[model samples]
Target: MNKVKENSVFFVSLLLTLIFIFWGVFFTENLTKVTNAVYNGSIDYLGWVYLGTTLFFVFFSIYLLFSRYGNIRLGRRNDKPDFSTASWLAMLFGAGMGVGIVYWSVAEPVTHFTTPPYGEGYTVEAANTAMKFTFFHWGLHPWAIYTVIGLALAFFQYNKRLPAAISSAFHPILGDKIHGPIGKTIDILSIFATVFGIATSLGLGAMQVTAGMHDIFDMPNTLFVQLLVILVATILFLISINTGLERGIKFLSNAAIICSVAIMLLVLMVGPALTVIKVFFNTTGLYLSDFLQMSLRFTPFGEGEQWIASWTLFYWAWWIAWAPFVGMFIARVSRGRTIKEFVIGVLIVPTLGTCLWMSVFGGTALDLVQGDHSLAKLITQDESLSIFIFFDHLPLSTLLSILGFAVVAIYYITVADTATFVLGMLSEGGTLNPSNKIKMTWGVIQSALAAVLLLAGGLDVLQTASIAAALPFAIIMLVMSYSLLTGLKNETVMQKGNKRNTQQN
Candidate 1:
């Protein structure tokens, strides 16, 4: 009782989360109808907000890199980065977007080739458009969204000595009111977003893992199997949580990166190597040239409105929904770095790597589909089987499938472990190292949520709900960016004043 009173954020959030899971499980249809209605409404009415906010974040990150505050360290002036550059990048990349990239690397490009954002489908133009849009979705824009929140959190929580929570980022605007109901409200919203977003991902990853197992090992893909996968994955990730961040997350992240690179190399070597190189360069050029037009592209008067809403708007909302979780994880690992370095590292490195991965897998998948119409149709039927189907035409098919399966599974563990850690941190008064009991509670809750949604057929609805949550959170993110700028300007003035005082002395 004392603990519950002391940690009202955790208890209230937990109670609400349980209620949500029950509603999803017992009243799946009603939940689906409600979430879909809200989702479609958001996409129909406020889609431009998602697009414009993300575009603003991209420019905001760039401005910070060039602004006078570029040299401001996230921590104290003399503090150094706790982790090395390579490990830092791996953790952020793995936590931010590991399995989703692998799952979509082949699936999304192939989907676009068949049903593009614009123009006729399955032509050379469609394939070119596919790669260009893939780059756009997985590239700088998403990372810029993450950078906005991460930079603000790190700057305020570390540099300004505020509490390590989402509400802390608003200290410049709210002052001490950040510790009142307003702060609790922000944290609760973050918790809801984190729990549902990750639960949706867990459910999706479980389904994809089941698909991989079915394709490779001839296992049955059923609800029971998916639940079992969640059970096993829950155990693995909880074990990782127990081992803590330095040993568990770091090791898994590094391993996942290595495995991912090896898989990409194998595909490049065995697939159309020259074509991939050409497509990467050519598509990169298109991405740059079409960046501005695509950033705010919508079919207000044309036929592509459905496509824009389905793909582009949906992706923007999903990324924003995930910002709190990924942003906090990145901020936690990003102490003791300069603002400019953090922006460049976050916005550029992983994006280049992601574009290359897409060029390899997505490029190769597109190449393969040109000659095999049946394969394209099969992939269109079920995107989860995309990587497996792609591996079927290559040499060492079985080996590639197994390796791909391992990557997805490892990604599952890393992401779940990171989410567990972040949730515990948020609920435990923003402690850097939350108690094992708290982490365990969240881990089990997440697993249960995934299992319940999988069985009740509420995963898709929950995902849509997550997207709906994005509209409000995007507003919060916009305010956070302003608050961050305010704090940075104040720091600049303080530094100048201190320097002048020293000179006079």
Candidate 2:
């Protein structure tokens, strides 16, 4: 009974996840119907909330960079950073994005070009718009979502000596209540969001890996192949989780970054090198000029509304759903960094890296698709094959495809590895070092959820699950910002009081 009471959050979250997996696996059609209903309703009614709240986080993150607390360290003043700067950037970038970026880099640009949000499709304007919006979707807004939540969690956990859980960030508002039902409820919500969000990525990774196999090795693109991909990646990530964060995840993250850069450079050298450079600069200008307009963009009474819902709103919700897992993972590794340093590292570095990636792969794809109706049609039929198809037009197609496979597979393992660690921390009452047993449990559950999502309805079902779980968590993140401010204000007051007392004595 005591053990159950102590680990009540774990037991409850596990039961909920198992129930969901059963529904997705057993009643696949009903699960699809219900999630699709929820997904559509969310877009129809609450789409504005997703846009507005994410924009607010962007502003809030910018505010913190220059706030009075900018110099405050995440841990004690004397504490030093655990990892080197390069390693830190690689790990956070790897955990925060990984499979999604690689999967989308070529696919999204080609997609937007063929079916843009506005104006005529398959025009030069459409190509320009495609790159601009890809930058927007993968840029500052998502990182802001990760930044504020991560900043709050790191502040409370390291500075205030609180547990390393989502609920702990609300101590200022919830007080002792954070330890009761309210706290457990918050953590449970986090678990659901993390599970589904990571599952979505896992499903995407499995699909893309399967696509690579089919394109390069002549393997059939079937459910069995996808499931096999997931199983193999699952075993690797589980091993990574057991090896702990410092060794397994760190090594893989660094390697993934190197491999990713290699692939990008190879594509740039072999395919439209000058066009990619021009596209990078041109799109950066457009992104800056139209950042605010696009940040709050919605088409309520117009032609592009459905497109916005399908693409922009979906991307926003996916990022929010991912916030807790990525945020906690980032905070875990960000001890001893000051607020200013944290923001630049977390927000600036990854956004620039992602935009550059989009420019390279997306630019090359755009250039290739010109006057090539069949290639465009092939991509339009299935986006998972976009990158592989793009490679077909390049020299040494076989080598490039193999390298791309390696990058995605590595990212797949790294993300699942990081996620299992974060899930373990959440389930074990925010312990920095959760036992291997707890980590293993979450690793298996997430892999199962990924497989079920794939089996149920493929990509559409995965997007719905992410958007459905993200709405509530977006609200939670907004509240967490206020709590963090309250905590910071109180800390300043206590410091001033102590200073006066010491002088008097």
* Maximum-TM-score candidate: 1
- Write the residue-wise lDDT of candidate 1 on 1-505 in tens digits: 8877669889889999999988988898999999999999999999999999999999999999999999999998899998999999999999889899989999999999999988888899999999999999999899999999999999988889887799999998999998888898899889989999999999999989999999899999888999999999999988898898999999999999999999999998998999999989999999999999999998877799998998889899999999999999999999999999999889989889999999999999999998887888888788778889889988888989998999999999899999999999889878888998998899999889988888787889999998999999999999999999999999999889988999999
How far residue 257's Cα lies from its native spot in candidate 2, in Å, is 0.5
What's the distance in Å from true for residue 92, model 2? Answer: 1.0
Q: Count the backbone clashes (under 3 Å) in each candidate.
A: 0, 0
Per-residue C-alpha lDDT of model 2 across residues 423-457, encoded as one tens digit per residue: 99999999999999999999998898888777766
Question: What are the runs in model 1 whose C-alpha is more than 4 Å off?
Answer: none
lDDT of each: 0.92, 0.90
Query: Candidate 2, TM-score vs. the true structure?
Result: 0.97
Which residue pairs of candidate 1 clash? none
Write down the TM-score for model 1.
Answer: 0.99
Question: Model 1 misses residue 297 by how many Å?
Answer: 0.7
Identify the leading candidate in terms of lDDT. Answer: 1
